[model samples]
Target: MAYTLGIDIGTYETKGVLVDTAGTVHAQASRGHQMLVPQPGWAEHRPEEDWWGDFVFVCRALLQDSGVDPAEIKAVACSAIGPCMLPVNASGAPLMNGVLYGVDGRAEAEVQELTNRIGEDTIISRCGNALTSQSVGPKILWLKRNCPELYAETSHILTSTSFLVQRLTGEVVIDHYTAANFSPLYDVKTQSWVDDLADDILPLDKLPRLLWSDEIAGHVTPTAAKAAGLAPGTPVTAGTIDAAAEALSVGVDQPGDMMMMYGSTIFIILRAQSQVSDPRIWYAPWLFEGEHASMAGLATSGTLTHWFRDHIARDLDPAQAFPTLANEAAASPPGANGLLMLPYFSGERTPIHDIHAKGMLFGLNLTHTRGDMYRALIEGIAHGTRHVTDTFAELGQSPKRLLAVGGGTKNALWLQATSDITGIDQIVCEKTVGASYGDAFLAALAIGAVRRQDISMWNPTDRTITANPTADYDTAHALFLRLYEQTKDIARDIG
Candidate 1:
């Protein structure tokens, strides 16, 4: 049987999966990488050493583990942590480390300069996004102004996924979803490069061709094929960002369907009939034709849990410790005895769009214990998810169903709390291999092994968690709403 390979380059790790057309994940491999922090709020990844190195490593490992001849693999797809910035020369060598998504804040001055030059209205209208650290246009300009020598040699800009595609296929192509984040530089209406904006910085010709996520970008090159143990000339599709692929893995294909990704960051993908713009939410064209998606992003999620465990609860082992913590949290009643936390460790992204906001824990007193603090942290993330859900309602686009994916869905406590906090029933899919698995599915669809709508046939059993907001939660939620309102200004000011 013909097989497909899917690879995902995440912030902390690169993973690959080999699968048959039937959605069975035959083999999988992953390798961890570092997140460079040169200064406060700056995140970078050396493309060659970090991104591509790990990608090639995982590809070889996955192909070996599958025990299937690489020649039998019909196609390949890639999903990456992006809306990232990677400036490359003509031969596709990284000029410097790629600026990471939202976590990186080195482009602060660029954001301000773009907002001043283009005005906020024009940015929103053209890009369907705002001048936040997430946009790549300002970051490109930042390189030109801040590092002239490196910027001078830059020929083309590539997102993380596009970078991998270029190496594999010898063709530079970017998907609309990832390209849309280059606000004021990517014209959303035309769905093409905005040559007129960057007159002197970079040429329009350097930009990669744009394609939908599932469309064929190119075939695997002979060199890449030999290294990856794949058949030469196997078709490679224009893949998408990790979040978009995660959403697809959960069957988010139509309006009112939403996928909530619980990972290093919290990302929501809500399917829409047409393009909708909200300053609070980043918007992108859907992977397929005839659909749009609105993104609700929080800069931190599992990252917060990692911080607490690694730094605060250093003595405990996470495998054994998290369950103990969960039990302790369960012992405590809801609301964590009035302790609340605003999970803005990496700055708030969705709803508020405030990059200056800092993390806050409120209502703590002598009565609170370590368990109370732990419980409050989980509740804080639940409250953040509530904010995202509320924004959807506010925008007149209420999702009828919420599907949870990634490691976060594995935690029953979190899933229940999130459901209760948002007053939405959460559906947990059993086969959640996440972005790589989804990318494999997209490849299957591209090669005509499966029909697009027939994805439901492979759906995992739904373990539903319904969070019914109680009168007690009503009081707590009212306070939760006001907590951010009263503290947002202070968080920004202090930062």
Candidate 2:
């Protein structure tokens, strides 16, 4: 039986799985890594150590653990935390640590500079996005301004996934879903790189060739095959970013179908039948060429929860702290005992698009306990989700089905709070192994072993998290918006 290998390089860890045509995971492996915060508002991952190293390790381990013939695996696919900015030389050597997604606020000034130089309307019309912390073009400019020597020496600009694919097949390519974040540099209408707009950001030649997500990038070369303990010429799909893969994993393919990915950050991707020209949210062509994707994300979600555990619940074992905290949070009342949190630890993204936004713990009092604070954090991220869903409603793009995926799906409090606050029932699939599972599915699709529509059968919905009426959540959501509005200027001043 033909099997497929899927690996994902995430912010805090890398995970991979081997799956057969029946969607049964034959083997799985994981490796944990740290996200470097060199300074405030900066997040970095070494591509060599974290991205490629994890891939080789996971691939070899999966083959060893499964004891399956390497020749039986038909294809390989991968996803990663993106739209990262990794400048590389002609030899594909990384110039510096990869700059992370919206969380890394190093390019805030560059985002503004681009908007001023090229009109915002021009960018939105041509690129389907405005200059924000998430845009890769601005990050390239950041490198040019801050590290000119390195920038001048740079021969190519690639994301984490692009770097990995190059390592595997010795081919440089990026998917449209991921390339969309390279706003102003990527032409959405033409679905290709436009050197005219990109010239000021970086040399036109620095960008990778574009392809749809499921298209075969290239076969793994002999060198990569030996490195990864696989056969030469194994087919590999043009993988996407983690959120897109998670959406695909759960069968989010139709119009109005959405996936609320609760990973290190809270990401939402809504499949739109037509183009959504919204500056408040991002717009990208779907993984498939003909479809469209309307997306939004928070700067921090699970990351904030981790911060709370590390600082507030530091006494507990790191392995067990999350479960313990979840238990404590469950014991607390729904409104988090009058505590409200703004989950902008890194900075806010989506609707507000405020790069200077700071996290706040409001309504904290002598009566509050650590459990209450923990509950507050979960609710805070939920409130943030509500904000994005609200945008969809306001824009007449409300999701027909909301599929919840990623680690946060296991946290009942977080899932329930999100549903209760958003009033949208969420569908949880049987397999929440997340992006790696989607990668396997994409690999299967690439090889014609499975069709795109087969995801519903491959990973069926397990259960639905129905929205429960919550009086406090409604009030808390109002205050959540008010708090951000009131603190807008203050956050900018302090930041």
Candidate 3:
């Protein structure tokens, strides 16, 4: 039986899956890694150890556990947290740690500098995106200015998925969806790199060849095959960033389909009918040519709850801490008992692209308990999601179907709170194994084993979280909007 292998390198862990054409997951594996913070407002990962290391370990574990022969695995694909910036040396060796996604605010000054030089309106007109922490062009300038010696040595720059693909196949190529995030350096209308914009930032020839996510990039090299425990000539697809693959896994095919990814960050992706120009949200050419995508993300979500667990819930057992905290949060009444939080621990994105923004806990009283604070944190994230959804609707492109996925989908209280705050029903899938599973399906498509629509059959809808609005949350959400505006400057000062 022909099989496909998929792997995803995520914020906190790497996950892999081995599956056949029939949608049966033969085996799965995961490995944990740390996100490094060398300074304030910066996050990095050691690519060699964290990315390729996890990939190697997971592949061996999956093959051993499943008892599957390597020759039977027909195709391979990978996805990772991206559109990150990683300058590499002549031989594709990383010159520095990979700068993570919008979570790292190290390029705030570069964002402002580019916007001032190019004008925000002109940027939107050219790239269909406003200069924000999410853009890679600014980050490249940051590297050039801050680390001149390293930048001078850089032969090429790559995102996480691009790095992995190059390591596997010796083919330096990036997917259209991920390449579009290099705003100011990519042309949304032309669907190719913009030398006029990129030459000003860095070398144009350093950029990777672009391909659709399902297109075969190249076959695995003999050296890579030995390291990754795969056959010598297995075909590898041009994998995308993790979120796009996750959205694909859940059958977000049509224009109105959406994916709400509740991981360390709350990411939202909506399939678009056509190219959209929105300053409040980022737009990109979709995984395939001619397709379009609109994306929004909060800098923090599950990360906030994680902070509370490690710092506040210190008394609970480590293994049971999350569930225990969830139960406590559930016991608290809605509206967090008059407490409200701004989930801006890492700063804000999407609707409010403020890098200097800081978290706020408003109306905290002496009577409040740990549970109330936890509930407020989750509610704040939901409010941010609502803001993004509202932006889409105001632009006349609200998603008709919302699919929920990721680790946080298992948290009933958190998922329900998001539904109550947003007033949009969310559908959970039967197998929401996320991006790795999506990668496997993409591998199947690349090798002609399955059609594009077969994903709906592989992962069926489990249930829906219908909207159940409450007056308490309505009042809190109203305050949520007002609180941000009122304290914008104060948050900046604090940050």
Candidate 4:
């Protein structure tokens, strides 16, 4: 039977899957890696270790575990956390670690400088995105200004997915969906890279060639085949960001469909009928031609839960901590016992785009327990989701169907709270394998083995979390907004 291989590099883990043309999983493997924070407002990943190394390890494991012949796998695809900023030298070796996504706020100054220089109205009109930490253009400018020596040595700039695809196929290429994040560098109208907005960032030749997500980039080289335990000459597709893959995996195909990813951060992607020209959110050309997507994200979500578990609930066994905390949170009343939390541990993204925003646990009293605090943390994330959804509604593009995916969906309390707070029902799919599974489907699609509509057959809806709105949550959400506004200045002052 013909099979496909899909791998995804995530913030804390990497997952891979081997699947047949019929979408049956033959084998799956995963590995974990760290997001290095060398200093405040910066996030980096050792591209050689965290990205390529994990890919090789997971590929070998999947092959061995499934006993699938390398040649039998028809196509290979990858999706990774992006739009990361990584500079590579002449031979494709990483010059430095990969700068992470919106969570890393080191380029805040560059973002502002470019905004002031180019004008925000012009940027939004041309790129369909604002200059935020998520944009790769400002990050590239940051490298040039802050690390002049390394910048001088840089021959090519690549995002996480581009780096992976190049390693596999020896072709430096990026998908339109991911390339759109390079605001002021990428022109949404033309769907191509342009230097008119910021000619000083880098030469156009240094950027990767652009392609659609499903287009064939190149074939695997003998060297890459040996390292990744795949067949030489195997086709590789132009991969995209992990969030886009996650959306496709859950059947978020129509214009009104939105994927609410509950991973390291809360990333939302809404399929749009047309380009959305708003700085508060993001706009990108969809995986295919002539399509559009609107995106918004929170800097911290599942990451905040990890912090609470490690710092507040350390008394519980690490293995049992999240489940124990969930039960405790369920016992606490809604509104988290009058406590509210601001989940800006790494800073805020989307809508506010405040990099200096601080995390606060308000309404804390001696009467509060770990359960209340944990519940508040989850509720805070829910409030943030509501903010994004409300923005979409205001734009007259609210999601007609919200599909929830990722590790956090297992947390019943978190799932219900998000629905209750957002007043939107969320559909959960049967297989929540996320981006990697979507990668397999994309691989199949690239090779003409499967149609786009077949995703429903691959993974159908298991259930839906119905919205049960309440006045208490509405009051708490109002306070949540007020708390951030009232204390944002203090957050910056403390920094």
Best lDDT among the predictions, by candidate number: 4
| TM-score to true structure, per model | 0.97, 0.98, 0.98, 0.99
lDDT of 3: 0.91
lDDT of each: 0.85, 0.92, 0.91, 0.95
User: What does the lDDT come to for candidate 1?
Assistant: 0.85
Q: What is the C-alpha RMSD of each candidate to the true structure, in Å?
A: 1.5, 1.2, 1.1, 0.8
The residue pairs that clash in candidate 4, if any, are none
The C-alpha stretches of model 1 lying farther than 4 A from their native spots are: 197-201, 469-472
Clash pairs detected, candidate 2: none
Best-fitting candidate, measured by TM-score? 4
- What clash count does candidate 3 reach? 0
lDDT at 112, model 2: 84
What are the per-residue Cα lDDT tens digits for candidate 1 across 282-400? Answer: 88888986678998888888888889888878888777878877887888778898988889898878888777778888998898887888888888998888888888899888898
Which lDDT tens digits does candidate 4 get at residues 94-147?
999999998888888899999999999999999999899999999999999989
- Which stretch of 10 consecutive residues in model 2 shows the poorest summed lDDT? 467-476
* Ranking of models by TM-score: 4, 3, 2, 1
Which residue pairs clash in candidate 1? 420-467
